[model samples]
Target: MLQMANYEFIRKQHILLGKPIRQISRETGYSRQVIRKALKSTKIPVYQLSKPKPKPVIDSVQPIILEWLRQDEQAPPKQRHTATRIYQRLVDEYGFTGGESTVRRYVRQLRVSPPKAFVPLDFPPGKFAQFDWGEVTVLLQGKQVKVQVFCMRCTYSRKIFVKTFFHQKQESLLQGHVDAFEFFGAVPQTVTYDNLTTAVKKVLEGKNRVEQERFVQLRAHYLFESHFCDPGKGHQKGQVENLVKFVQKQFFTPVPCVSSLEELNYFLLEKCISYETTTVPRSSLTVGEAFEQEQQTMLPLPPQPLDCCRVVSVKSNTLSMIHFEKNAYSVPVSYASTELTCKVFAERVEVYHGNKLIAEHERCLESGKELLQYDHYLDL
Candidate 1:
């Protein structure tokens, strides 16, 4: 290959000095064809390989490595094989005697090329949203505690709502949706999610889900549809998945210290509201501006929000306490040994006798502890 200096000299000789290609070649490298090519263009040519170099050692194990990588596409994200793991497997399982570096280079090449193609999805206003749960660590009253983050992102506007909860229980999940819908001031036509146990009882074949009964009730009350991503395909709901990370990094970074989860949630809510002025990518409109337009197309908020809770029927024991979630709560002595309905919420548990609300108490986090209200036992 001719250096750029040599090529430039040849071109200047013929083009600037008015010298013929034949004379230039004779004066420079004595190659008429090379001189003519340089004079024809001012740009320097970059050399490229006509074919990839051979990998003799890797060629034998190439098929095995490729098969493992293909299988990894369906495996759980954390369980997928690393290049080191693959190299070890090759050595142990196949008794290969190649350098690990060689296997690594070939593995990286296979992973980089032939990138997976994804169809670009476009959502119209009010079409859908994505929901996801993420975990974050925060200092609660000077103690480190891990909390579940509920994230919802509007598909078109990219507006987000984030809240923290003690757990991703069914009640908390339903309440998250309720709060998110109210935050946005309207419900979207559909919401996308992973096959979370709180929402999906069973993941049926291909996108179908046996949604939990409480989750179904939430949808019925709001008049919206629920869509579950395929198993191990978190990318299907990439919007909220990204939001989950964003909240952790942007909002919770440095590990917020608050007196209570309620105070932490207030901070999160303020951060979400402040994001409304931020611009969306590939568009000029701010998130709040886009959300304003989207609100027009969204479904109207129902007359009332859904009662976000889980109901379980339990009979009071001989001690005049009904057991729920391994915790017992007192009811009136008259209602002892009678079947009652317990509506469990994130913050509290309400026990109902027939149609009347009989007892309400703050939900206890620990198991095997009985919560007794003095008023409930006063009639004893």
Candidate 2:
């Protein structure tokens, strides 16, 4: 376990300073898992030295009281002695004169700590944002497949963006933000997250973070702050946390029968925008109305959207195919046995041979799947 000081640093950096875990890890040299462990604990994990209390009154009776309680551990829950019963028994048997309240207090200490309360939070207009991913089951091609729902919501205005992806990848992470920001027509000042692997590479002590290189590039492009909720502390980002559940229940309760993620996401976008007319708690204005007000405070959208895609070079086989991320895509036959470039966009893959476009195919998410364009084979 990390010392309380280290835990405090993770919380401050991740939750307050809006630093990503990767930045923390690079700065502190602590593993992301360790950082998360420290974050899960709300209280600092400091070991305080217990000062000896002047318990001369209970000193002699302490052993007797312990033995009785230890034996009672075997008794039925109903039959176990209550505090009053124990105090009476002490006076009748061993003649303990300690106050009943004192005995009751000691007994309480032996029990497990009480459950923590969920803290309530609200955001000021255009000040905060939240991002999270939730899984939903969809019926595609007569098979039930799980898909990732990337959700981003403006905390104050309740404006949101919902998109679906076949998997969660770093590219998808950046793309989700780009789409969300474009949808909202502005960028939020700070965005909160849980320790999502795409953006965070490590968790470090206090205000220090090691963010993913690509993530850092995305941050630099849009210039929004990144905040991470404590590990297991979803309540810190409770709005999106609840939104995750809400998306599943409200949008996906009836399993969506769709041919592709794009179709389902189109449906989700409508649902997202529909929330605009609903009134938020303690507010007279609709969600859309609040968003309209918050829009004035937002940072203007960039002139050109960031191209958040992953580009890589791969050697094409004799069959004019190249494998990437466990899936195979094809290029023109003339490019066979040569090094071809693949630009992986959010929804499609573009194959290029020396800057000339050879082929384009819709990206596939299923593992070990191959997409072949008949035009590429037509030359043969």
Candidate 3:
């Protein structure tokens, strides 16, 4: 069989370079007839025909195999059977004698369409939203750091709220919901989430989830229903999942640099709000227009927002700094060698001495990081 490269080279040399066929044969090493054939053809060389493999065993079990593959459309991607597993099933259940490679080869040719059809989803205003977290890298104070970005998307408006946190712990998760609700100016009636550890304490059968206590508190306070996707089925909350990447790509691209995480998040929030004016997919209206309709159906904000702060009292070290979660923040030098109360909020840390606020510093996300407020101390 003539190889493709020789044919390509021959065609290129003869047709494009205006080289004669005898010279082409001398340079390419081909018969005149083969060269003539190559010159006449515009298409690439391909095998004339493929003979079907003989599969006596597979012939009997082919029906069974197709049924299982068809049923796999509904199975979770991880739980679906592999070619080897399917072969095993055929051998065990149907008493079929077939080589695993044959089964694998046949299965490779098999495919089923997605179980769910692609269709437009319409959400009633304020009726639905999606929440999720995405990992993003940012340069904070000249140090590169990884942070979790919490994303919430209103299903109706496609309006979004984005916040970044060093940890996806309960405190950050709850605080994200609190802040997002405050930003949206209303709470969605229903929120969808994958079985995120910060929200789900235990996964029950089917779509049931025993949510974390803090997550439950958030739901109760906001009076919104919480929905969890089936195991390995995050597509149910695809809106926020895409928004998570949207936040990372469109918002975090060029790798945002900021003096503090708080500053970076403020920039992201502005970007999120600005997205409202942009047109939504498959809809003629802008996100702001959709959200405006949603706002009417969305539940009203609570009289008081949840206390999303985590407060702890720590004794100030000789350096007049208090430590929390491996990060240290300085208070007034007078607080050195004294016990002070430190209240840690999502974006800042407040230090108090005997019920008097002494110092406040931007929250730090890294271990062994030190935050010192300029007004807290005067160097000797």
Best by TM-score: 1
TM-score-superior candidate, 1 or 3 = 1
Report, for every candidate in turn, its global Cα lDDT versus the true structure. Answer: 0.89, 0.86, 0.86
Residue-wise lDDT of candidate 2 within 13-113, one digit each (tens)? Answer: 99999888889998999999988877787775666658866777667777877788898989998998777887899889877877988888777766657
Q: lDDT of model 1 at residue 291?
A: 96
- Candidate with top lDDT is 1
Model 1 Cα lDDT, one tens digit per residue, 1-380: 88789888887777789998777777776588777777777686888899987878999998999999999999999999999999999999999999999888888887786757987778898889999999999999999999999999999999999999898898899899999999999999999988889888888778777888888899899998889888889998988888888888999898999998899989889999999999987789999999999989888889999998888888998889988878889988888899899999998999998889988989988899899977877767
CA lDDT for candidate 2: 0.86
Over 94-118, each residue of candidate 3 has an lDDT whose tens digit, in order, gives 7877799989988887854457677
| Candidate 1 ranges with C-alpha deviation above 4 Å | 11-29, 45-111, 116-120, 332-338, 375-380
TM-score of each: 0.83, 0.69, 0.65
Q: How many clashes show up per model?
A: 0, 13, 0
Runs in model 2 deviating more than 4 A are 1-119
